[model samples]
Target: MGTIDFDGLAAALAVHGLIPRGGIDFAKGETAPPGPSGASARAVLLVGHAGSSIWPHFQAWRATQPAGLADPLDAWSRQVIGAVAVRFGARAVSPSDQPWLPFQAWAMRAEGLRPSPLGLLMHPVWGLWHAFRGALLFDNALERPRNPDSLHHPCDACIGKPCLKACPVAAHAGGGFDYPACLGHVRSPSGSACASGGCLDRRACPVGTEYRYEPAQQAFHMAAFASPSIASAPTSGG
Candidate 1:
């Protein structure tokens, strides 16, 4: 097999506007366990935009499609992850399945860093606004070290904690978010606000406040949330 040029792959992804600001690392099973499980060598994360503009595009796409198709977003996600895997000789996985904890652990170990408010040690630039679109694991080793440390968490100094208080249902209070309650509210027949727009609480997060989803995007995602597939899928952090 030809040598994998990680720097080149990173540059290509950036050019395509998939990755915002994150780094690459060797998981080594410390963070992503199962001892590599015969997977690829590198992982790539596509953190979605946390602003209003993302909605219109989503709505337009969904409107043109037939019902019960795999979530369009999942298809888009696969294209991105596949591109990275093909370019870097790696394998990919979805965050909806693996979640962020293991990846965060691997990143911290690889980079020798900790979490920041705006940029967690594991994921920088996205703060909580970021969600992993997918990851790529490679079978070959590269020469890059862990990313450098960042010392800022925008939420560190945020007063009022708007994200905690913005929930109309009080779902995010007391350091624990009430999922069933929040989901219930969103899915409730009376909750037209979610269908019309999106979650008030998530938009209220002071950190990355600029990244709120546009109304159309909000509707699209809300539609997905209300879909039986997503509603029945296992839950994760908000």
Candidate 2:
């Protein structure tokens, strides 16, 4: 089998529009929690980037000039992620893996890895505005990095925890988010403003403030909330 040069892989992803930031770890001999498919050959953790144009093609699709508006970013995201997986020579797993929630809980308890104020691994450069498109699990073992640094958690020092405070319905309190409540609000008639204003709580985060999503981009995601399948997707922790 040919050896995989992870650095080269990262560079290729960057060339293909992925942010291509952060560490890659080998999972060959490690004990992974049981799940749908077996453990991945390696686990790549991508650090979020500010103003990444990874999905710009989708953004353009949303701007139908004649009709004045179109929205297809989610479909575009899936296609982009699938292409990346094929390029990496690995099986692609959806971002939502129900069995992985236990692992996320474990990571939070053992590693001080709290979900970002936006309910993700808060990135210093992207804050809570970024996402993991998909994970590529190779069949062959690859060399992994040592001593990967833990990313800075901006919520650690914030006094007001603006993210938690910004939610109009207090959806992010008591250690768990009320998904239904949040979604209900987003789909309600009163939620039209959110479709235009973006996520109030996510925008409230001070870290990586410059990386905030454009109104159109936010609207695309907000519309996704109305999709039952996407909204109820199982969480996959990084």
lDDT of the candidates, in the order given: 0.54, 0.57
What is the TM-score of each predicted model, taking all chains together? Answer: 0.71, 0.73
Q: Candidate 2 overall Cα lDDT vs. reference? A: 0.57
Writing each residue's lDDT as its tens digit, candidate 2 over 156-231 gives 8888888888777778865678877888888888777775677787778888777677776677677766655554
lDDT of 2 at 134: 50
Q: lDDT winner among the candidates? A: 2
Instruction: Give lDDT tens digits, candidate 1, residues 129-164.
Output: 444455555555444554555545456576776667
State each candidate's clash count. Answer: 22, 1
Model 1 regions more than 4 Å off: 1-3, 14-16, 27-66, 98-101, 104-127, 231-238
Candidate 2 Cα outliers beyond 4 Å, as residue runs? 21-52, 60-75, 97-113, 147-149, 228-231, 235-238
lDDT of 2 at 47: 23
